[model samples]
Target chain A: MKYSGIKVLWEGLRGNMGWKPLWRNPDPKKSYDIIIVGGGGHGLATAYYLAEKFKITNIAVVEKGWLGSGNIGRNTTIIRSNYLLPQNQPFYELSLKLWENLEQELNYNSMVSQRGVLNIFHSDNQRDAFVRRGNAMLMSGADASLLGVNDLKKMVPFLDFQNSRFPIKGGLWQPRGGTVRHDAVAWGYAKEADSRGVDIIENCEATNFLVKNGRCYGIETTKGVIKSKKVGVCVAGSSSQVMGKIGINLPIESHVLQAFVSEGLKPVIPGVITFGAGHFYVSQSNKGGLVFGGDIDGYNSYAQRGNLPVIEDVCEGGVALMPMVGRARLLRIWGGIMDMSMDGSPIIDKTNIKNLYFNGGWCYGGFKATPASGFCYAHLLATGTSHHDAKDFLFNRFEKGRLIDEKGQGNQPNLH
Target chain B: MLIDHPLLGLRDSSEFIYMGDAKLLNRPNWKSKNSKTKFIDYGYLRKNPGGVHKELWYHEQGDRSWLVVTRNTVTHEILKVELARYLKRKENAK
Candidate 1:
């Protein structure tokens, strides 16, 4: 059913019983033209765009669990395109643009709020780096502005500006960047894809690839062996395990990245804010809870739980940035496995196995790249070519020395 | 998570910074003709086993010594720990 103010009013008058399930619970078909593994945001969005843009509706998205059960629903919900690298800036900018009109395109309230994302600088060197990044963002046709200390104070007065160790200098603000309802993105894309005749089969795990002559004829799943002309693997943290089933060892490591939400408070943070001295970034949720996160657990693990030391470390950063946050009682914390790539960028290229594609290694930037990742993956699956915006995300970039090291952290998956 | 350092005894894992696979210390001869392929394999590829594996850990907060830690990736159990410099000396003596 189409959602609108009139629909809400009509339903309200009729006891509000007209609402239907977001997406259909369909059984897996025996075969499909294209089968996408993993039903997170990227998989769902790829299915949606494959049906809408390429008119390839004979698609099925197989998920081991329910939709949005992965990193899609476990992120801090922030999005931005303030990148300096040429290989990354354009792709993320396209994602930001897609997010600008996502709600209307999907006909679902994903709540793509462009409240802005501010990256604070504590030193002169950091400010210069941000200046270069902001310039790169503008060159990519994305909005960016360098905000001074006074502007930051006016915007977010709760920050501890006079800290002797790390004083606030300035910040690079992208006015077009903000947060969205994470799980709603999954539901919206799943609904749109289902509406376009794409089957979203939940509880169906792709166990192994049925490759006789390395052409990837089909997949063996929990349900049964389903045949497909092409198969795309888009599992985020499980990328290694899924692809390893076929002896494809990716340069991706699975690390547990934790996120925290505080008890509900009054509206405080106007937008997303990142502390430059450390790895802490925070934004206030619509429900008035402060949602935040920091670096990964620094070890390779597939577990969805984090140790206490990282929690204390993240809270320390938060307290150092804004002392007021220390008083807010801790509510809850959760962890998601991140498929961190070596060069701090993603990979969206076909594997050595013909007709089998891979899309993962997003690191911390996966949630923001949801739309563009899907669009580019779908474009590649529909046509046998890389999307113009995603040309740098080649699988062999590291081996070829064309690495897109956005953070300039060399060859470290955890640092990225 | 706590690592029982051989010298420092029971230290929090946070006090130490982790670097993957102590095999990184075994640098291949750059003068070799196949150095490019060797470096690529050394820099990018890793065993990343699920069982006991040797890794590098720096005790930044306590002894300030780099250690070669043999730990299980699945259970995070520390099997052995030795100073990396000592291990290097032993290798050189050998």
Candidate 2:
């Protein structure tokens, strides 16, 4: 049912009995025109756009588990397009724009909050880098502004501005960047796609690909063999494993990235604040808990748990940035598998195996790129050409020596 | 996670810096005719197995030596640890 204020009011008057399930739980069909592996945000969004934008309704999103079980639900929920590289900024900017209209388009309350995201700088060199990044964001039709020490102090007075180890200088602020209810995004897209005659089959794991004479036409799943004219794999952390079933070794590694939430407190953080000197970023959730995360556990692993050392390191960064949070008790901690690419960017291109498209290598940026990744991936699947903004995310970029290298960390997944 | 270093005994994994697959030490000759293809393999390709993996870890805070660590990616269990320089010497001897 289409949700609205009137619907809510009517439901409230009617004892809330008219509300229905967000999306239908349908059985897997024997065949589909297109099959999207993984029912995370990217997969659901891809199915949604494929039906809504590309007019391809005979699609199915196959999932191993229930929706919102991956990085889509395990992130800090912050969204921004503050990228420096030309190949990345435009694409992420489009995602930000799509995020701006996502709630209305889906008729679901995804909580797309545009409270703003501030990347604090601690040194002159870092400030210079942020200045360049902000300029790039502006050039790419994205909003960005340089905030001085005084400006940041007015917005976030609780931060430790005079830490002896790493003094706060300024920040790069994106007024349009903020957070969304991460799981709601997956649910919204899944509901919309399901409403448009797209089948969403949960508990169906793709065990292998059905390839014949260098062409893929279906997948062997836990449920049964399902046929599809085209297949798109967007399993974020399981990219390598799933693609490996087809004998395609991806230029990606799976690393466990952890996120944490603290006990609820009064609203303190104005928006998202990223620590400049280290890998820590935090924002206060609507429930008053502080949601935050840091670097990935530096190893290749598919496990969804992390060691203690990374936790200690992340706490150290939090204390260094805002000493006030040192007393806040951590409520919960969880990890998501990250598909970290060598160049710190993503890949959304077709593979040599005919009719098989791959969309992964999102690393830390996956949550923010949900909308555009799906839209462009749909464009690729429909038209058989890479979307204009996503043309540079080809698989052969590595062989051609044209790495995007967003973080300037060369060929290192963990470093990125 | 405590990594049992050969020389330094049991050390916290935090004290070491992870540098990914130990195959990185096998540098390709840049002057070779097929250097481009070899470099692509060296720079971009990796067999990130979900099971046992041999990777490089630097004891940056303790011994200042690099160690090739054989660990299970699925279980995070360390199987073996050895000085990378010794492995390099052994490869050269071969």
Candidate 3:
């Protein structure tokens, strides 16, 4: 009836030791048409898109660990397109579109429930900001509705509507945004792509790039040398280390974010709710637990075990919003490292090196953006161009001083 | 910012206040007349019980919603300002 210490159980099942990744194909022969590094959501999604959309079957998604063992399995799994900035607005909307039809598209039950998401405004200024965002969503053809306190009362009756210091002014509601099974998103793509000739080489760690005449031709993995025409780097949190092997420095900071689930209850919350005042976001799982998470561990950390401050901060938000959850008890909390960019958005484009494509920097939204990200990353790999609208998220954007700074924090996840 | 309420404890703050007449935010596509002008505010500053800031808040974004903005016990700045004008002023001065 509880999943509190599931992390330890997960490590035991996968035979994962401290600091080593699980599900890695430790003894893989490194020769394929395409070699993808890092088997997280981004990499797996890339492989799925390469096979499903581009018809490029001669691919090998080389993962150092088992699939979805990285940040893919660690996120709180809330998906929404209620961003205010223009650069992120369309891109996130595209991801929402993918989530809408993902069950039909992947032919796998991801359990993606469109339970609606709400961003509550606690101040006149916050209300004004939501107004701008709501207007932007309306203009961009997104399904957003600004809700009143009465509407919120009708939706969530137990909410402390009037008595709190920060009263509920109103909320920006996105009817289509909700949660999904995070691991299922990864396994769904892996199962589908694996069935379609994509060599999901688990336990294979790509250590170095075999560059010939200043162009990448193949990768030298820990297992053996794999010959490939083009190599796509879909590693998420460990992207910088993987790219460093190829002499590329990304402005990516590896920060750890922890997610906590409460002991199973008889489903109190019907939909996902994010605190506008804080970074806390929560959604009830089908298994009856309250899944929640907050901001990253402010500093860079390779260690997956998070610190104490964020835990306290997130728990405080939970208790303040839903006081009844205080008695439910904390079941388990786990940490995953995210390759948080200076900006909160992701980067999906070709590097300056020919044949070396990159897809990283998914800041907490990687799970929601999995399908569209992989689809676009595949298109970028095959045609050397973006599929939908990811040209702004190029690595060159950092050099050109054109950062897509979401959260308006300006390229710093710590600030966000 | 301590304000007593039946639900919110001692330190609740409010977000913004609509001193003037404003419209309540609504769902544009909803097929009901009560979609927009649905609620009215109680024209008083309460402690904004929202976790981050401590200030009085008003939902004048086409919706007459009210909030208690919990701000710092010392520097009384509304923790998260949503009003574009106030935020723009603060940001522009910087």
Candidate 4:
């Protein structure tokens, strides 16, 4: 049943009870050509692209829980291509391009809004650095614009621009940066993948991998043993535990990242605004709630909840930037475990084990990289080569000392 | 979370700065063969388990002493806390 305006009109006239379930909930099969562990945004997108682009329909995405139960539904939903490094800029730019046409390509609306993103800079040196970063973004074929204090005052007059510390001087804006409906991405990809004959097995956890010699050929799941020609693991924060079953240690740490939303109010914030001297970044949702988040809890932990100190710190940052935020009643707070990589970047490459791949280590920024992570991981699974855009996100870079450390915080996952 | 400090009775965790896994104190022999690979593994790889973990937390705003805290990552419950120097002395005795 294709969803169109005519279909909607007919359904509206005829009882309006003709809506169907988005995707199938089929039992697990004996084997598949490829098995993607972790049916989050990345896994579902990988399956969707595998069928849509590579013409590979014999794939199964096994999830420990239901769809939209992981970071896909637990993120701040901000998307942007305003990266600085040569390795990260082109990759994120590709993601932004994909986000532009994702709703059309999937025939589902993910609410990819490009309301623009403004990264505030405090000091003159920070402004100079942002100027250089803006040039870098422009060089990578992405749009960028610098705004001074006067322009900022005209745009968002509510900011505490004259604060004693961390005064806002200017900002680097990306006009094409904004938020999206995060869970819709998972559902759309899952529906498309299921429509293309790819099986999505929910509540089936991959307990262990069938490793013989140095190669992986299958997985032992809670359901049963499932054979596969190739396996790709995209289990975000669970990357360490999932790969540790094969005696492989990763340069990834699991830390709890917290985000909060306030009670709905009149529409105020235009787009995403990030504080330069602090870890706070905020945007207003269509529901009029102010959605915001700060840094991770700055420790290694698998708990999906954060401590109170970090919450207090994040709220202080919010109040410091926008004094009006202190008046808004805090509605809700949530946390998701982040796979903080050693260099504050993602990893999408084949592991040492043959025919087995790993695509975790997204740190705190996986939500914005959903499409490209899937596209690149699907390309790797299909052709046995890293996609050109994701070639720098290899696992060997750590051992080879060619790390793409964007933050320059070497080896310390907490600091990154 | 309140971390039970060894020197000071139960104190707020905000007073401490978390460093990382306590195994980092076991720095590999740099003069040995394959020091590069050893250092790379020592510097990068980690066994970030979801169960019991021994980590380094510095009492920056407190007594300014390094302490090893054994805690559960899943529950975020502190099990035991000990001074790092004492633990090092015990390791050197071994």
lDDT of each: 0.91, 0.93, 0.71, 0.93
Error of 4 at A18 (Å): 1.3
- Chain A TM-score for candidate 2 is 0.99
lDDT of 3: 0.71
lDDT of 3 by residue, A82-124 (tens): 8887877887888888888887777667888999998877788
TM per prediction: 0.95, 0.97, 0.75, 0.99
Better of 1 and 3 by lDDT: 1
Query: Looking at model 1 chain A, which ten-residue stretch has the lowest summed lDDT?
Result: A246-255
Q: Alpha carbon lDDT of residue B91, candidate 3? A: 56
Winner of 1 and 2 under DockQ = 2
* Model 3 spans > 4 angstroms off: A1-30, B1-94
Q: Enumerate the candidates' DockQ scores in order.
A: 0.44, 0.69, 0.02, 0.89
Number of the predicted model whose TM-score against the real structure is largest:
4
Give per-residue CA lDDT, model 2, range A336-357, as digits (tens). 8899999999999999999999
**DockQ for model 1?**
0.44
- Per-residue alpha-carbon lDDT of model 1 for A87-206, expressed as tens digits? 899999999989988999999999999999999999999998889888899999999999999999899998999999999998999989999999999999999999999999999999
* Residue A5 displacement in candidate 4 (angstroms): 1.7
Return the TM-score for chain B, candidate 2.
Answer: 0.95
Q: What is the DockQ ranking, best to worst? A: 4, 2, 1, 3
Candidate 1 Cα deviation (angstroms), residue B2: 0.9
